[model samples]
Target: METLFRICFFMAMMRFSAAEELKRNLNGVVGGNVTFPDPVLELGFLLGGRGTIALVNDRKLQIVEEIYTNKLNWNRNSGLFTITDLQKNDSGVYKVDSKKARVFYISYNLTVYDGAPTPAVETLTVSSDSCWLLCSVDKATSLLWYKDQEVQNQNSSASSLPITVHKEDRDSSYRCVAANPAENKTLHVNVRTACGFNETESGDNPKQRAYWSVIPAAIALIIGALVVWRVKRRLSEKRQTEDYAEVQINNENPQDGTFATSAESSDHFDSTVYSKLKLPEVTSAEPDLQATPT
Candidate 1:
């Protein structure tokens, strides 16, 4: 009878080993579809009998036996375990025990990542050495600057991992990719910014602050040239008046109303009677100088 009982126990042990022989394979954590990856993937183990399946990561062990809330549980004689809605945080090795004569172990690694940030927008109208660049991304993990598919650098103005970006490269069509490293989640973003002013091609490019300098110089030069011209014109007019006076004082005769060769004849001539002359009336300190030529 004892031998028979031992034989029955051995048979039971063999059956249990055969049922749990399906070896577990580690899932790829980097890339591939995780069907319903929104929730972290649940990993359970086969306890064989009425035992339990559990996982240990960072010294924390989470057991699975009953369908408790968001976790998957198992019943007696169950050999399959599950993981749900997995993220990068769910990475680590999980252990399972059948409480019998078999213990299975598998290692799983999780990864997560994010895309770049979105760029701001504005209006700019300019050309030449100055080109416009743009940047825009939403919920992105990393931002890589590029020009014609060539990865550029982020400059000193920013404080992100992607270092070296230029201020002048703003109006460009920027791209961003967001991802969850643990869940292998990924997304794309496109951004744009208005082009700004560029002085690279102007024929007479001048300093912006010096624009006011030319204005004062032009005004002063114009005023000085005008004063010099007025003085010269007055001098010419005086010389011409003196020449005409000398001729009149040398010869003229108003009595015959004709030119003469002697100064005495010019002295007796009436200057006011020749030209259409009108003189101002006398004042207290001024005389009416319109008397006869003599």
Candidate 2:
């Protein structure tokens, strides 16, 4: 009776141990590495098993279906199994058994998926004193907002979420996380001061610098053109005044008339006029006196 009771106790203990399953949930990206850590202690005596037959002191790991032959590797000492270049077909339940008990010991639930899309963040001003940060992604199940790597909002389940930015957060970096069952993606942006948008590290804008530089040059060119025009005008007026003064000086001299002729021609014309007018007056007077005497 005592032997039968001992047998029943052993079976019950085995059933209890088998009912306690060690479940591990893990995620793996496509074309990446994933490792299933052994839950058994290093010093624990665990014999490898195959079906109902137990291999005595068998330390070699026995994969159930041999589904992954080329990509799987195992460490006997640590009882760790690693798979490289993970594919979608690798997603499923992986079981490790204890050889001494011929029962499953550890089970790993792995999920493999393609990478998630990176989120895009933008800033908008709702009012003069209020601002909103918008985060967006394609096919995202949820959205999270972060300030300086610290989580600000985590309850968002939409692809897009809007967060209000405060005055104190202007100098802090804002981040957005877009997540799904496959993976998580993040993007960040630096916020500016309360008065304006974020400036470059040098505290200057290239376009503004270019505009300022061009302004001075344009003003200088305009001033130079004005100075050149004034100089030309002054020179022209001075030349006109000099010509007028020369004309006035010439007019002040009495010998500088327009119709004045040469001296020799005037004297010859006066002598001819006097000879014609004197005629034979003297000869006539002498003849009258001689007839009276006869």
Candidate 3:
């Protein structure tokens, strides 16, 4: 099944053109004149916003793009063409009309892969000549390339994974990618620190030393203040306790030589003393005698 699909895949790859009035949808996409309900076919085109592909007069046209490196112009023997990065510019209709195969041929539909890969140089160390770089792509593809960011020393391979690069190529930021001949797909590899290239540490040594010294000094001052506060509190508490005790002692202790004595007096004031006097003693007797005479 896969073989038949591949066989039909390379047969035709139509391009966008104004001469052919291709169907906007997939009804006109898979094109072959073969009459086969069982013949498998696989056709791949770069996917994008431009889904429109045509097969009339054969002058393929797409919006001009920078990294588009491959031209899978549909022809008689170009069985299958892989449009690497299905780009936004590739969106439109795709139509194929080939008379090579017979008995019901089913062509595949559009699959777009228009994302960029991340590629980078990992290490530029080991004498600058033996440095090795590691690149990773965001979008995976079978076609990989090692590109020097500067000087344009580029190498290609069939790998969508990490590709090892040399050190002399390290001068430029290098990246890994998965690309197709059509150059419709594009991705860059991620990059990081390189070996052998020494970057200066951020701060000055003297400045770092100064900062460290001040931290210890500040810590010492804080500790000293805390100790002094504790000692002063202890001393103040002791003094207060001593003063309170002294006041209590002073209040209980006998002072100077003063004495307070109570006197028992014989001379007393009586309220009935005047009535019991000798002159008043005869009054009662006189009143009684006058009453008897009356």
lDDT of 1 by residue, 1-294 (tens): 999999999998887676555343345343222321111123333232334445433333466555423644333233344555444444444435433343333233323222223343222333444433433333434444555466564432232323222335444444422223323222222222233233342333355435557789999999999999999999989766544432232133454444432222233346633332223445467677798977
Q: What value of lDDT does candidate 1 attain over all alpha carbons?
A: 0.41
Expressed as tens digits, the lDDT of each residue in 55-127 for candidate 3 is 2223343423334445333333444333433454443433343334432223333433333343433443344
Candidate 2, 109: how far from true, in Å? 3.9
Question: What does candidate 2's lDDT look like per residue over 91-136, in tens digits?
Answer: 7776544434444467668899877767887766644445787887
Q: How close is candidate 1 to the true structure, as a TM-score?
A: 0.28
Q: Is candidate 1 or candidate 3 better by lDDT?
A: 1
Answer with 1 or 2, whichever has the higher lDDT. 2
Provide TM-scores for the models.
0.28, 0.55, 0.27
lDDT of 2: 0.62
On lDDT, the leading prediction is 2
